[model samples]
Target: MLPALLRRLPRRHRASFFRRRMGAPGDLRRFLAIIMMIGCVFLLYMFWAQPTSPTSVPLQTFVPVVTSKDSNTHYAKIDFRWTWTCENKRCVRKESTETGVHVSLTTCSMLCGSSMLWPQPTGPTTLGSHSVSFDREQLTFETTATEPARSYIQYSFAMFNSNVANLIQLQKNEPSATPQRDFNKFIVKVFVEHSDIVKLTLSTDESYKLILRMEGENMIGTVTANNFFGARHGLETLSQLIWWDEFASGAGSLKIVKGASVQDAPKFAYRGLMIDTARNFLPVESLKRVLVGMAANKLNVFHWHVSDSQSFPLVLPSVPQLAKYGSYSPDMVYTASEVKDLVEYARLRGIRVVIEVDVPAHVGNGWTWGPAEGLGELVMCVNVQPWSLYCGEPPCGQINPDNPHVYDVLEKIYRDIIELTGESEIFHIGGDEVNLECWQQFRNRTNPYVDLFDVWGNFTVEALKRVTKANGGKRPKHVMIWSSNLTKRPYLTKFLNKTEVLIQAWGGSDWTETPELVSSGYNVIISHVDAWYLDCGYGRWRENGGAACDPYRPWQTVYMHRPWNGDPVYRKSVLGAEACLWTEQADHVSLDTRLWPRAAAFAERVWSDVGTKSIYKQEQLSIEDVYARIQMQRERMIKRGLKNEALWPQWCSQNPGMCL
Candidate 1:
């Protein structure tokens, strides 16, 4: 009786009865109600927080350069005006167009229809009716539409603009009260074909017209510029647009897929190639042909090795004799207009032209002065009796930096180079291979070891700064030197701060053996010869009885070689990589034969992920097949009336990689 009574009371005394009741259906209903409330909150937050995809709405842009009533539009010029709105209000914005009109010039301003350019009438001028305008970030062409003989017109950005930066900012911004921040998608539409007259229908499916669409909530672009074009036209055109439809379908010798679009951008910020013209004196057209190949692979920077131990092609405005005496031809030097044309061509392709005037060491025969204590025929002593005349003999001249006049000559030459190249920053003044032995031999009896080497290097730096400052400021300029100078690190450190310079580590044989120079706190560009040097012939050549040292590098080797062997050197400083074409076995014809197909491989390696392990992932092309494609493109260059096109190998039965 007591136990029964205790059990009945315990259920009441311990509160077990209430707790047990709570664990039943009634409690489960309450737990499910709480869970449903949490789920609702989560779904609501997701609905408000998630980003939207880029808008699918069609956005078309066109910059019509000409609309002539005469029905003959061969030479007719029309300025382009184009624009698009962002569906992703969060994206930043930037853009450029080509209308063959220099809006900056004072002579041709009539078409502005706004304050973008001052009004002017000159040189195949456009009348009032064909005016263009940019209003509220929208580009409008106010010309009457007509039947154009040519169905397509195209243009590209002439210079780098802040539009891309703006687009980025816009994309990153959250929805706010601001007009630009109210959206989620970014859409850019470009028109590939159009009639001279406005049509009722502007769909992409039209026979004579097409639209390229790109949409992104957040977008980034990688741009490349070559020193040869210095204009960055290929990138600009890719950034903008170019149409070859004026030529017949086959006449243009190019093809595009219908309704095909790509969200394309560069993998690396700088994709570059260097050509040593000093050794083999190539024609200007040769440079253009090389640029054409570079553009195909999206290579941007063109490092022009204009001067070396062999010669100097630039005609300094201050000192005209260099062009007359130093160049391959009297009129063969790059004229101001010719430079502009090259710049324009490269600008169309989005390439940056970087000019290299190798100095102090490889100024060639004309710049050799100073003492000669067995400093070889090319090197001149820096100290004793440094002031000398060009005797029309070997070892003719060396600019004595201490003599003020020599420094002046150097300054003038560099300034002229800047002005001729239109003062694009990032200049290369070669300060390599100075023979201290010669300086010691040519010692002034009065001041033994007058510290001239240090003084000369210091003066060169000052001279470079002067030219760079004269053009713009420090931000626009970069001074690049070979890693061989790392051996002279003490000299470099003593003369100039390391921050002001870029070191190109190109000690092919010695560099790969060690990584000390890169780890030593210097911004280094890797061009390791054993791996990256395109000039080294491939393995098959040696198999076929070629010189053992002179192995040919097929495109595969270039595609596979890594810039760094997982060294800690990258953590300290590393700018990027460059592919060099030494002219020892190169001219115009052999240049493409050797450089092309291989250069394409280098471009891919440098631009793609450095950690990418597989070379087989790329287009599975044999060395012979690669050359065949290059030949086809080379033929296209020839049809464009380029003289250097003749330099490409016309026939090669044997595989370029295999001697057999």
Candidate 2:
């Protein structure tokens, strides 16, 4: 089309016609072309003359700019002149300009400040007394305690000395070590204030008053408590109070302020951490490390989920075949001696070890000893041809509640457990997910009178009786069960007594189960799976490959949980809350990282005041403050040989406001 149109006009006439139509004639076009060439040359010249580096200009006069200093830091502004190059068609020249820039200037050296305590004290803590310092070689401990606390005092001192040695080693080994003066000699005085020595019983008092005063060269630290347990708590507080600081000289020194006083006690009687060792057997050493971590956080109850459908690792002398046939390996079992040692280890750290032997539901391994050993064919075989009649999971089984031999075996197991872990007043008879279908299937093969409820209720009742009878008529203070036992079958209450059975409300369709159980006239321990189950977010145990729950719970979510949110009327029935770690996806390698920091959140919630809400909201303690404390606590755990996961990058921890 264009060619045809151009062909219609003569070539010479087209040029004139196009030039006229285009709004420029010969002289104007030539003048415009010259202007365009000059502009291009000017731009090229400017590009060539551009400075490769920033230009600096000297100040004509010394002018000081003042800035308002904040208590946190100081800032300053300075004005200076600089030369900038500009090019045009006519000429190129440099111009000097004055401008002010603001900068933060250090007014004083950054020094270490007082550190915050973890599982922060529930009572008042005041600082205003004398300052005390300690050197690794000069520290000494003395105890003035009642006869009952002598052993505890000795143990506490040993732990304190060990911690001191660890801290010194950490400071020396750390890459950022600083030099400071060698600390002075200090004395720690432990006094049992109560006249009558309290035995280390289940009802032992754990409240304590600690006063640390600095008196000139000699620092006097006193821990006064009513019982040995309280004194142990005081010792933990003393350890937390002592922190090391790096001086400008680069040397590390330990110090405790002279006039600091702390009167503290746990908000709940049962601040617990439930560890499932049955899924992935944790060695005795790993279990001890867990206790140490729990002790550092002041968690009192170590709910040892010792057995499940997968394995039974606790060695029972009466039921020797259980561990022999069920454990992952012979070495994986916790022998009777090892159990005692672990119990004592936990006792020394002021933590009670509660053994959990999940019966009926999670007892596939319990059936391994065979009917020859008086064990019944109580559960349908998982590998049986007709899979529809068996348990939910492939290769799973429940204890045969109908078989009289099941009770006999339970009696022996409970007796052995009671004899082994002597101090614990509570035992967890896991009554969760009993698989009524399995029981129904088995019932078709037996008498009709023995239905699922009858078997379960009778088994639970008999087990409770056996535990009490085994304990020399001194029934365990509480035999805890899962919420499903009571919630699903309220009629089971007739067979189970509220005074004897404590309902651990967990794995509910919703979080309302705790309040519902408490309102139903039952003592409850809130272990809501959504909020307190530490193992959920990791992943499904044996699934194809996916997280068990979406949006893995962060530490903040764990911190926000309040066990008794719905009803205040049954709050007293709420014994406490526990953080459960089901180890389907967890083993020794990933245990510490998976549990700590997040579990610390639950620890604080259970130990702090009941009214303490979410840290996100403005309360007496802010979330930022808690974050700082927890970060510091995480470091302390690492120093104490706990392989806790880091909460944030080191830069964020060192520079507080940067991350927030």
Evaluated with lDDT, which candidate comes out highest?
Answer: 2
Best by TM-score: 2
- The 10 consecutive residues of candidate 2 with the worst lDDT sum are 102-111
What are the models' TM-scores? 0.53, 0.77
Give per-residue CA lDDT, model 2, range 107-188, as digits (tens).
0001122226677776776655233445656668888665656876788788987876655423221235343333355678
Error of 2 at 589 (Å): 0.8
Candidate 2, position 623, lDDT? 59
lDDT for 502 (candidate 1): 71
**lDDT score for residue 520 of model 1:** 54
lDDT of each candidate versus the true structure: 0.47, 0.69
Candidate 1, 417-510: lDDT as tens digits: 6776654446677666555544555434467746766656675677666666556555343567665443355665676556667777776635
